[model samples]
Target: MSRRGWTLFLAMSLIWGLPYLLIKVAVADLAPVVVVFGRCAVGAALLLPWTVATGQLRPALRRWRPLLAFTVLEMTGPWLLLAYAEQSLSSSLTGLLVAAVPFVAALAARLTGDEDRLTRVRVAGMLLGLAGIVALLGLDIEGAQLLPLAAVALTVVGYATAPLVISHRLPDVSGVAASSIALFVTAVVYAPFALPRLDRLDDASGTAVLSVVVLGLVCTALALALFFALIREVGPQRALVITFLNPAVAVLLGVALLDEPFTLGLAIGLPVILLGCLLATWRSRPRGAMPVPAIDAAA
Candidate 1:
């Protein structure tokens, strides 16, 4: 990958990863629904004009049904769920759970006819990653009655479905357009609940507002742009390796910024998750897509 691709990927990793920490901060003042809605609204605000300028708006609008499904699955359902999950779970844990995306995507791709050979290397890496993931689930899955584990499982499904939606339903759509539309769709979906509390956001601190804005403009929008660029360079399969970096940043931020716990278990598990990420995206280099940036891995 070129220097720019690596730069974008690393930036995206941190951008996406930081959201977990930001959610932790935002929940201190705003409700999860409002926060999620605001994220969408702000992201859409950031991208709406470009979408219009590019003349993709009408075509995107005409494909509302699939777009709606993509929005619900990609943005609304899981983003909201992760926000809610953050109400109970830690940011580091959220990052850990999301690490399954590559594994999930690989399985989904195989099911969807990606035609990539499932080499022994890939299979070993996937399983090892899962084991590391299981190890990281320090919480007794049986005892955490609320099933934070299960909540994250659904989050994994959301992550898995996002790429499929992009490749299948919105292949013609640029990543910017798809993400912006998803944000807009998120705002629409959550409006009934979020609109009622618009005034409540006024009570939030400047930090919270800034966090939400960065989350939208930088993370979701810019990260998606970098993501697609990487996909174009390296193809989605190989470019997906950055998922590993994103979670690492989240964990690091949690420890440094949020004072999140960094137990021996977390120490053990983090490496495994990173390893899984590497394994899953290891051979994805086909040189068809644009070279990916590795700057930050929040995405």
Candidate 2:
């Protein structure tokens, strides 16, 4: 990767890592629906205009079926679940749990026919990853609530599956446009629930309010833009490696700012899970196959 690629890579690591902290802060006062609504609305407000101006909106709209599927999986369901889960689970724990996404994504790829095989290495990685989750749950069982943990589990599956929808079904769609429309649709869907709680914001703390703003403007909108740029710079495969770094940043921010505990489970589980993800997603090139071109961000 070039200097520019490294810069974008680092930026995305921090940007994507931030939402767990921000969501935790926002949900301290706001309803989970409100937080999700605000994030989607603000992100959509910013990106939809750009999509239209670039003429990407029409193409994205035409693929509404798959786009909506992507939206529900990626944003609508996961964001709500994350917010609700954070009400009980610490941001650090939530981030660490989500780090398992790559493990799930590896399985999802095979099931979706995006991957040709589920090799022994990947199966071993999955088992290792499952063990890490068991360690985290067993060690920190007191802190982890069953329902919220289940919510996070569902969120992980959604995050893992959504990208396959893009790679297989919406491969030619502009990522910016797909993301913009998804956010818009999510905001619209959640409006009924969120609007009723809008008055709650009047009593919310400055920190909570600012967290929502940052979640939308920085984490959702700006991060997506920079992520696309990173894909262009380093290719999608390398760009996706940011997943391994994001949870570390999330853990750091949670500990330093929120004073979230660095538990024994976290200490052990983090490394094991990350190593599992690394092995699970690793693809050895065939001896004489041509170098794969940069997969479009739609993947």
Candidate 3:
């Protein structure tokens, strides 16, 4: 990778990885809906200049159905699930769970014939990934809250479903426009649920507000810009190395910031999942630079 490309890769990784920590902060008092809503609204607002400046608005506006479907599947559905999951899980742990996304995408691809040949190694990777999740979440009925765990499970499905949506339904749309419109749809849908709490929101810590704002603008908006740039300079395969780095960063933040518990589950589960994801996504085929669209990878 060129120096410029290396910079973009690191920047994008930090931007994406830091969100788990920030989301934990943002949801400290706010409901998951509020947190999701705020992030989406802020992201949409921040994204406007680019869409308007580039004159993509009219063209995008014309493609409303598929665009809105992208919003529903990629943005709104997946995000709310993440926020709900964070109520029980820390940012770092959530990051680790999200690492399973690539494997999920692989499975979805096989089912859909997007990448039809699923080898034994890939199947092994998926099983390992599932085992990791089961171990991490645990089977002890007494120790767990079913709702939160279910929320995380839903987040996993959302992650898996996302790649299918983009790959099949919205492939030609500009990534920036796609991301921004999705955020806009998320904001619009979550508004009614969040607005009643706006006045109550002022009492929350300044730290939380800062976390949300930074997450919306920097973690998402800035990170996405860098993601596209990195794909261009280094190509997608190398730039995709950042995805492997995110779970580690999340674990660090969970330990350092939230003082979340370190369990045997995380210790054993994280590595298993990461290794599985690595094998599942590792390809021998030739490549061109393309963004690692995690939202789309949710499938």
Please provide, for model 3 over 34-112, each residue's C-alpha lDDT reduced to its tens digit, 9 standing for 90 to 100. Answer: 8888888888887766777887777777878877775675568877888887877766456655656656655566677
For this target, which candidate reaches the highest lDDT against the unseen true structure? 2
Candidates 1 and 2 compared: the better one by TM-score is 1
List lDDT for all candidates, in order. Answer: 0.71, 0.76, 0.65
Candidate 3 Cα misplacement greater than 4 A, ranges: 1-12, 116-142, 225-244, 254-278, 286-299
- Model 2: lDDT equals 0.76
Q: What does the lDDT read for residue 250 in candidate 3?
A: 63
Sliding window of 10 residues with minimal summed lDDT for model 3 = 290-299
The runs of at least 3 residues in candidate 2 whose Cα sits more than 4 Å from the true structure, single-residue gaps closed, are 1-9, 116-139, 227-243, 254-283, 287-299
Question: What is candidate 3's CA lDDT for residue 197?
Answer: 87
Compare candidates 2 and 3 on TM-score and give the better one. Answer: 2
- What's the lDDT for candidate 1? 0.71
Q: Give the TM-score of candidate 3.
A: 0.74
